[model samples]
Target: MSRLRIHRFAFLGDARPFGDREVIAEPREALEPRVRLGERPTDGLQAERHFAADEIGDGHGQAGIERRRGGRVHGGASISAHARARPGRAQKSAIPDNPRRKRGGIVEVPFRLRFAFAMNLSLYVVTVLIWGTTWIAIKWQLGSVPPPVSIAWRFWLAAAAMFVLLRAMRRPILPPRDAWRFLVAQGFALFCLNFLCFYYSEQVVPSGLVAVVFSTAPLLNSINGRLFMGRPLRQSAIAGALLGLAGIGCLFWQQMAGHVDDRATWIGLAIALAGTMCFSAGNLLSSRMQAMGLHPLATNGWAMLIGATILTAGSIAAGLPLAPDTSPRYLAALVYLAVPGSVIGFTAYLTLVGRIGPERAAYCTVLFPIVALAVSTVFEGYRWSPVAVAGLMLVVAGNLVAFDLTRRFFVRTA
Candidate 1:
């Protein structure tokens, strides 16, 4: 006869019995022909014995034993098998059902979060490149047309193209009546007044200099967000803003030192700053519209149309030419400004404002100057000075500090 081997399995939280009996039995009775191990007897002795043995070990011990068995335990005797057999008293899962939970001490990012991050990064790159180049394109539009008229034409073409694209996608072109009020306001601030100021500023200043003044947008966005949206004022952001302002002053000082008593330069700086403020306001409006379930492209589409209409009427009343520029370079610039600069660039930027908060989204303004200055060097003969370089560094440093990138890097490394 085979020797009676008692396998004790302990389950930490389980109170169920295991094997045939609760007490140990002598080998003669345990291995009796009537107490067959392979098959159950009609008196239910084998079932009782199996459960009695299982009750001896903790859940961890049972898990260890099951693993040791290479998950090939026979007779439905494993802890998992027991849980399956008795559904009510089954052990709960060790891994959480929450998608964000860590497994084996490693945290996992969900697919949606990764995809969103990628999209935001791509949008940032695209917005920076387009907006940077748009300053030069705006210069091309200045020779033959009034500033407001040029702006009107640019946005009018942009609005028409947006509508055509929307129609192609079978998306609704008209905003809801309730949204029209906000769309009108967005139009004035973003498409109409902002561009008008910027275009006029470009006439008096180098486009790169205008871009430098406009780089104050992140600071303005933060202040506006705190005042209107009730976002908490961060010390880092405030410090960053001050540093950026100082940098701008340094750059301006360099310019003034070179050309003192230039009224147009001062006026251009003031107008560019005002336009930046308007840009920040538009950011907030776009954010609000996004919160209200209005898509950025749709809002921008309607707003551009309203802005174009108003600008067109204003230009007509002001006796500005309503005729389009026929020059190849001017036309090319207009098309580029309408499509990529206004349509694609605004869509990408406002989408970022919705995805990230407006304050963070405005950092793109900080980056825009670098691209603008590079383009200006090639086209407008922009020369970099030591003071200007220092100012740029300070501005870049401020942004890093404001966004907490510096702290995050240290923390991650530590």
Candidate 2:
């Protein structure tokens, strides 16, 4: 007399595709104590398949008794190994979570973050440090190599590194033919043009200035989402955008001061704006690709290869220099971009875009600058001006408005 409860399983990252699974467990107490804290399995089958005893704290309880007692099966359930292999397969019988009825071995987890703020904070800091310093790294490579050439070489190296890593793990390198064009477009917009604009703009403006300007990416993305996809535009979105824009204006005004006539600075800033536009465009493109069921990591790898080809072609056409002295700083920066910045950052960002959609994820651009500012403070001894402080405050306020963080505050307070 087993009560069948169908369970579905979903994976967090691109390592696995989205698939449903079914598991028969007692309708009542089938999943109680065995579900781990913060473990979000799609269904009971997934829980049984992925969760370990150590991972799930309590013993598996009986059906009707626990169903009537514990209120609901909010957490903990284990899926059988057989259930995971053929996700489409129908369940034969109820999978119990009883400690006394333990059967198979535990699945090994690759990495565990425990959903701690400190863990997230650390990851955020690492991401920003890698990104912020890359600005200076990018600046250093400017005269030594042509912009497009540098980008081509950087991505070639990145592609190579990613290839080796993926291949070592025996991950498939080949993707469908249709995926190539989309990957190339993404790479060009995301890696090539995005970097080119930023680098060239830096030639005209300070890195800090370029960063401050790029912070508007989220606002642009929000607008793009609304116009392109017909997503509902919230008032908070408009307010948030305006607040962020006003903050940028403050920074611009402060920087311009009596030097507003500086043509080069203005030009550079304009280019920076253009680069941000490209970044926003890439976000939209990636969103489309995700919808098509392409994994971000695989797509990014292929796109980098495509971007590398396009950039190299451009470099050849322009007779740009391709070589840079393989100094420690240069190599280090390149590796950082290849791994943490390009690989890790793109993966995180794209996945986030897939989950929350591009608009909300663009918030990372805003926060990333704060990370950059902190790095600037340490490495370059950057100090805030009174006006800069005001601008920072405005930026924070604007971000709150744009993302509707204010709503969260009110909700919590209420």
lDDT of 1 by residue, 1-414 (tens): 111122322211122333321221111112233332234456422221222221111010111111112223332234444332222232233222465544443223344334544666687789989987887777677778888888888999999888888888786667778888889999999999898888788778865477567767877887898898765566766677677766665654554465336888888889988899889889988877765556677899999998999999998898888998899999999999999999899988887776556766777877777777777789779888888788788878876676566675667631
Residues forming the 10-long window of minimal summed lDDT in candidate 1: 54-63
Candidate 1 residue 104 C-alpha distance from true site, Å = 12
Q: What TM-score goes with each of the models?
A: 0.70, 0.68
Per-residue lDDT tens digits for candidate 2, residues 15-41, read 221133222222222333344433444
The positional error of residue 188 in candidate 1, measured at the CA in angstroms, is 1.0
lDDT of each: 0.65, 0.59
Cα-based lDDT at residue 405, candidate 2 = 58
Model 1 has an lDDT value of 0.65
Which candidate comes out best when scored by lDDT? 1
